[model samples]
Target: MTGDHEPLPPGGRELPALDGGLPLIGHGIPFFRDPVGFLARVHSSRGEAVAFSLPGRRMASFCGPQANALILGLQDDTEVDRHLFYDPLLAPLLGPGVGLTAPSELMKWQHSLLLPLLRRDALTRHIPVMFDEVERYVAPWDGHGTFDLLAVMRDLSARIAACCLIGPRFGRTMGPALPRLLGRLEAALFAFAVIGPRGPLPHGLADRARETLVHAIKEIAPRDCPEGSERSHFEELMRATGPGGSSLDEDTAAALMVNWLFAAVPTTALAAWTGVLVLQHPQWLPVLRAEQEAAFADYPPTTLSALHKLERLSHCLLEAERLHPPIVVLPRPAARDLNIHGYRVPRGYVVCASPGLSHRLTSVFRRPEAFDPDRYLPDRAEHRTTPQALIGFGGGRHPCLGATLAQQTIKVIWSALLRAFDFELADPEVREARTTVMRLPRRPCTVRYRRRKR
Candidate 1:
């Protein structure tokens, strides 16, 4: 067999390509309508590496774990380009300090400062903040009523981002308006994901929201701070400096913090999916509650010790993430004619890998469609022993940085909710809404809840 680097050896068949019937939106409609289903069908029929003539550019989806390791594992932009993949959508909201939109070297340097904030030690402090934010956000919920699960989860996530990510000072400054403005930012992201980025986006709305964020953050954020113990992520960002102690300006500082939210906050998707899945599989309800009872014994589940004891709950959440991944596909533009997964991908083709598809492959998971949390148990770790078997969090070299934070946040949220009240889905048949950014439960995913006697 010819190598990916070698030219289509003489009579070697060209990489299989598919073109949709539409003009401007070739295959995008199907992709947006049912991303996982369509992508899986394509990979099942065609070869692992297949190309689609998308609206503006061509895209090559490298399916399965091997493709994930090959495509997502690309460290630098030498072969594949991440800087351009989400630039148009993320540039406005995330600004440009330590992200795909910034210069590679500058991004690398800035990442050094930003990443520590998401580490175990740094995140330990945020645990209490997440619990506090969830409590305050859910305080308004009545003793018994029907509510939109997705909306509640989204609001809670925004609240946590304001206090934990932007700092409590920023949260207090914005007060009631914190989530409103932050919602505007998330809404823009939702629009981009629901409709494929190849389609039109609400750039104007995102730009206005970002300007507001930059202004608000610049007003309260310090230009620089003496290196020392920090209270929140923003404080650490204020202390970060470039070569020769080049201090961060107010605007850049604000934008960098916002960018961190994009990287650090896992949005409402994980928690929301966990909720829907838990409700769908009522069999696990008592299991999770029993685990929580023990985990929260004597100490709040926010503590590391308590959190570790909630192993079964964590396994159930892992099952949810595997079933309903937030983003259907992770795409990076190929820098040049590169050999990817033994396929000749030409320059500028958007190289793609779908965790949404890989997670459900029967080859990777036994009875891939079944909602069995036991699969995550140590003895039956089906996702183990493979490089990228579980790509739900975009595993491999470029895994999701916010994955740990997201899992912790969800566990905390569940501990609080499942302890305080008993909830049942008003519509038990809740399925994932078709959005690439957040796999929210479809509309009318209402839940009935009542305060429980502790």
Candidate 2:
């Protein structure tokens, strides 16, 4: 019998295995039932690092500080080939571009080109467009009525993302149809991932959507570019000169936009959870509303300088991000065989970290389950205590480049909403959004809003 402290044999290390599963499916049932809870239980009972199986795949799960640092610290010998996990699904919709599936070198280049567009200065310039889009979307919801939270937010976020990323030309050209089409494409991609590409739904839905989007962008991209100046987000991306001064072809450029949609669309939509959770807490409503009013009284949130002063709002959004992380799980493949917390992680083995689970650790959060934005306050800053504890926008090598844009978009949307109306959950029965890849507030969840008397 092997003792707990005994030296293990080659290729044989101690890895706690999660029990209770039916034949063939392994832990699939329990995992699908409640992924966040299942992972939390694994960390509590089996330790921070453990192993689990799903159908034909062998996988490892990591949690707590040590595991968090290992996976998100950007130093581990782990690499991501998203196509390995999402190829059958995402590749067709997002395209085989650098954003979807790229080697380290190409990914680095893509980040370099894209990051500048999403930086503070550039993002500030786009704030007006974002704010205008949010105002347009929410203008209708002012009167008293219960609106589907996820659907409304999805449409709101889609308009904001489209305005900022795709430019006003394509945005104006497509109008509301853009968001609806993109939503359809996004749904198709998720379905493909779970149920195979050829599974159930009609073929070419995504292909058609992508064609429409690409065709519109290709037409407007040139006109949106200044005749001689290197301005506009789309212009910068189009002018991105690769190694040896080479530029992206039409197809590749379109593919990058598709990939950016994958990153920007869902994350922005999921950020609406901030509103869902915040409205549920009446204690924070007045506080948030007061802060938003005062902040925008003298200075419009259409600039980053003014937006940065909304500390309470920032805390609320950060807390919401911690609770409802857009991308719930990050999976990495071991670049080579290595020992991770006594487990022999073979090359190509899948190791995943769930920010959703990590955010709820009692050791890291005072009251992990409760929503306390003040936990991010200067004095009690829990996230500051650990490097990887607050992974709202992910971390490590492939951290979200559109993070600043996503946050600013959320801030603008919420600021506009809080200023215009008072709202609460219509159903009052909160539920986690059922999503295969991303984490979002569930639909059928409605918010009743009434226009505030000035």
Candidate 3:
């Protein structure tokens, strides 16, 4: 409704729905109640693409690596339109021809504008920003203390995201409020996807949150760095132009920043879960510490090169991401008719894939559910076999834009934690990660820590 995409012609074969459902409402109630659990059950039974039991909508749920590749790649092309799915939920937030809700050409343009921030050398320098954030974050845990790892990591992730992505000055001045504001908008995509656009949503709350961030974004005065000086991703977006040198409007630019921060805040799930998993598997601490010592000896832990040398720690982070992916289901709309995995998928039907489900396939992962970082190691590299095998950060051409930043943030935080203190779980209970928004621990992952004697 928000974008200028064409309407679907009402003449396509209906996809088969998942079993066990009420009469009229179908499986809407259960699907809304737990999107990930419902999808897991669906993935278990269905071969590739299976329809969810919701009555009004026709969504084809795809599982496994092949399915993930098919949908994530095909959904944005000729037959499928990415905007049709995103615009309903996100149009109100990102607007037309901007970021996720934009058409292919426009989306690519906006992406190109943002790409300068992720340049190789630029990302290398960002490690210190993350390290500094983590250093200040865990400083309060003096001699001994107990705290919720998830909560602590979320706050720390927000600070790093603000400082590194938004701008160092703005992050310091206005960083504290980004989490609460951005949190309101985090669930909009999936909530709207499952419940439908007309379904119950805190429209007023999200609107207010978006406006507050936009207001803050607009406050910063534009500065000229002359020629080759550095600029934050926020500043880059603020000055960047779109098609034919046409500058993005103020709200559009703010929407782009909002999108970036959205990825940073709640999706800090990776950094948070990485800490939780390492704590849960205390056996790996020595291995991580040894690698840390070696890495730091060569190039101080503050540098990006040092973090890159932490291959084992990085693998653990990847394993944690594999086990607890940020988002459960990725769904997109078909603008025109297409065939998916031998099924005749009609135009307007939504096609979806679950990173949570796909990542846990026994065929794909050895000891799928366990914290086995060696799965990514050279000897038993299970994830390397398939194209979209490890889809925690998406696959095909639409991989997560912030995947590198998320990984760097995790590295910096964990390296700092491992070096500065000794941590032990307050409650030695290991909670399994679930398929849901953020995919972090619902219950408290509390831990006790003491300042390490250097």
Candidate 4:
């Protein structure tokens, strides 16, 4: 906790902070071992805003609704940079231009072009594609058998996201190569702590993956005038910006796609599996099933528009996000010196905001730990107390661009599954995957599926 002392801001709060353990490691052990429990304990004892030292770096964690808002609001500040954490893992996959590392101007431009595709009109256009993909993915499930839902979700989402990002043909053409690319990328990320820029093992795998990714990118790259272009977002982005109306080069595009995979794949899988896990709860299943039945009765069961009407299902997903946020801790580096609750945060220090901890504050959510979807209903609107309190998709200028897409995809898959089969968890005590930063399921979440009685 060694740093230059400065006077606290007037009328600001000063609080106790954690001095992390050991040299080099800092609080990495406790953080990775039991992140949720560790954070919860810290908040209980230290209050909402606390500071900690990790490997000579000082960090302040904001755990309440107020802190969440402040951190997210800072996203648009030229001083606040997201690249510190995002660049290392995403650069090789999504290219430098697509992820946080891309120049801020390019990121803004890309966002503008891509926003329409995710808007209501574009979402409407894509619904049929989503439903068709969902039906295809679930077609193989037997009514009386058990299967791993996690694997099912990963494959399904990768394919669906591929369809949305590139096009149906590109998704199909690249199918055989997708898994290997994903595996290599995942391994590289896991090995990142040990792998230096010149490290033999990490560099070797990254190089190979980059080659495959580049080839795939070229295959999907735009050739003709970008009308009804599935890859138009990328082409239009290039054509409308920078030198020759283009900015991100091939490698950057590849890296950005890789970053997109990291962003979209695991989170989508976890959200889908979490929905399934929630459905397995005997009490909630009946209510959810009833909602599904009613939503389907009024409109065709297979369309996206119909699924949008399933407000109860949306609430269930929201509740799941609240209870088990896929990324429990959102880490951002300070772009400039700033004061949070009177505590001085110097530039380069990493600041953390934990949704897993903040979402449980009873101050904002009644029975915060309970899985009560009704709490999110418009009338209750408990989360409206603070914008930061309900940031499942994050907040501010850098908030997840794919949030709507992720939500829509999850709802579509769940709706299809519930309509087709009755399911339950194969194991009662199956735990979620908890790494230092990301939280997901450990393996294929097995569930027994039986035909629903019509």
Candidate 5:
């Protein structure tokens, strides 16, 4: 009955404790092997919030909707402790300023500059450019009967984000080199498992990738500033935070650019691929297509507003996000002592609110296992009851700043594809790729597309 701040019980089950999993490895193995199943077992047995450990760390898992609300609300107090995972993994490739590690004030300034560029007006100006790029990329598909949509979507999202982040000319010029840079960075991140006490091997490949990105960024630096118009967000960040101002320096900028890829590319690609796979379910496609057609009836058909009008399409995406979130577990280390649901959590303990498990709870979502978009429709309005439960974009102050822009980009791409082609899953056994970090569709996920008949 007490709020999250209420004092914990003296010595009962309410005391700071660890539950589930083995002694040292803790729950790391099973939790990664089958996250949903593991969390279900823990929640059913231990009640809403249960304590568990991972390797050298002690953490608590929160299962209920209330727990999600409580955790997300603390975003301001809890700066993202990137060191535990992101820092160690990504530091080799992306120096530092890319994500949560950037000095707080610099991040805020950069975000403010970036937000306006992703606003409705800016999106309107950029759709034609985005659509043009998509068309060029997909143009070769005519002769290719079957191709992995996963790779194609990844390439598409990365290129589009690059264009939006820099400018059309710069994005196009660097487009060919991007996939290589991304591959190198990904390899470095994957190499973390083997990065022993000797420390990560020189990582020459990752270093070269960073160099390539810096050269590309410098090549595209504004030749002559347009009258009255300021520099691009990336340029602004470099100038303000560069050697002179906050002076982030070239290596830092390269790292920040790599971080930009990490922040936007894979996650957006995953959402796009998942949206496609979800649409493959025979029952859902027709409804989604109809909704798309109706929404575009009077509008320019490619505008941001037109894409937003596809209520069912957006709902279907929300459902897909609920079912297969790109980032599953959000970990936070307590800065000070805290009490939650009668349990005391001491300082430095990690606590996680998993969208992967929480979104599947029937208490928060009706028929939580099924792909039912109507559950989020205005009439049902299930997500409204507990918005934090839908934490696909995280929550509170640190909520994914790129969320709206990501959604708008996804919707536009989906709209263009659906309008031009009829697509169905080419492989019978398509499955989602699972990693401790990001979720994506497994490779060789081919989609058969044909020109839609009028």
Candidate 6:
């Protein structure tokens, strides 16, 4: 019951500790294999705050509402420099100028510059492009052959990231190569995280991919940008200045693009999971369709006003994220000593919160393991009681800036897809995979799509 500054009472339990890690690798294997289960087990057996080791460093897993709020809602004592955790994985690709690694003032400036793109007016303007991208990507699905649903969604997302965020010309110019390049970049980043730059093949591929991205950015430099209505993020980057009034250089521009892609690609990947979960819960299909029908009775739900009416779709997505968040762990480096639920956490310690574990806690959620959008209903509002219960997009000082766009993009794409076709999972028992970072749905998760007979 004591505040963060208050000292622990005499003999009060210290942060519950859990350790059985391998000699050198520490808990890497177990932590990666079943991160959700591992954290949950530790929290249940140990306590709200459980300390564990991972490879080279000791870490603490903050669980339940009290610990989760403490970790996520940390103020004045902790900060999210991507270097804290993402450095080993993405720093090579994203560089240091992005919001991920930049200082507070720099990050604030970056966020302010990027805010206009994600605003309601901008998203509304960008809807046609999003719809076009989604429709064009799905046009070939004919409801005939089974396709990897996640793969399709990922590719589509990459294209949308290019088309809407960068420019349609860039998207089309890159064509299929953009996603392939992105795939290679992501794989290489993951590999680097696992083994360092050991293998020649992956390292070479990553190098080449980075070179290609840099070249692409230089090729499309603002001077080369076509006049008229080609909305390009590259141009935006060129025009934007830091807090010190310096325009983005090639490295910073390219890094910002990569960072933006990192934010976008994963959320869009989760769109596929949303589809899979909804297909598994067939009962919701009719409900979603009905809601869409009512919401867009007068016109298609592509506009900002129209998109707002699709309440049920939003609920379903919220529930899906609660059950299977893409970014499971939110890591922050303590900038100063801190007290969390009375546990003394020192500066430089990697304090973490897990949406993957917290979302499934029986204490906060009624039936944590179940898929129930009703938990967010007006009457229920389960997340209202907790400070940071639903952190699929993170929280605290620096939440995901693109979160609103991510949800809208997913909703728009799925709305169009569901209206156009009926989806049947090739394997109902398919599960989500943990690929070192995101909680992705299984590869080769196929689905049969049949065009809606209107």
- Which residue ranges in model 5 land beyond 4 Å of their true spot? 1-24, 75-86, 183-208, 221-233, 239-247, 297-302
Best by TM-score: 6
User: Per-residue CA lDDT of candidate 3, range 1-454, in tens?
Assistant: 1022333344444566677777756787776666667788776676566886564556788787876777777635765777666777786654456677786777888888767667787687677677777777767666988887877777778777767666766566665577766666665544555455665564565678888887777775133221245654556666776677877777778777777777775456787778778888889999999988888864334466777889999899888878888776777777767666656677778787888788888988888879998888888889999878988888776888878878887888888888888999877765543333565676678888888998
Q: Rank the candidates by TM-score, best first.
A: 6, 1, 2, 3, 4, 5
Deviating ranges (above 4 Å) for candidate 4: 1-15, 54-57, 75-78, 176-180, 193-203, 220-238, 242-245, 297-305
Q: What TM-score, computed on C-alpha atoms, does each candidate reach? A: 0.90, 0.89, 0.89, 0.87, 0.86, 0.91
Can you give the lDDT of residue 362 in candidate 6? 79
Alpha-carbon deviation at 276 in model 2, angstroms: 0.9
Sorting all predicted structures by lDDT, with the top scorer first, yields 6, 3, 1, 2, 4, 5
Superposing all C-alpha atoms, what RMSD in Å does each candidate have to the true structure? 3.4, 4.2, 4.5, 4.3, 3.8, 2.9
Instruction: Give the C-alpha lDDT of model 6.
Output: 0.74
Error of 6 at 59 (Å): 0.9
Model 2 clash pairs are none
The candidate that achieves the highest lDDT relative to the unseen native structure = 6
Better of 2 and 5 by lDDT: 2
Write the residue-wise lDDT of candidate 6 on 1-454 in tens digits. 2444332333444666677777766777878788898887777798778777775566767777677666665553233234656555565655655765676677678778778778787788777778888888777765456778877777777777776666677777787788788877777766665555455766787778877877786676444342255545677777777776767787777767766666666775578778888999999999988888888855344578778888888988898788888776888766555566667665566788998888887778998888888888889999877888888888866588888888888888788888888889988987767663576787878888888985
lDDT comparing candidate 1 with the true structure:
0.72
Query: What TM-score does candidate 2 get on C-alpha atoms?
Result: 0.89
As for lDDT, the candidate ahead, 3 or 5, is 3
Backbone-clash count (model 4): 13
Worst 10 residues of 2 by lDDT: 1-10
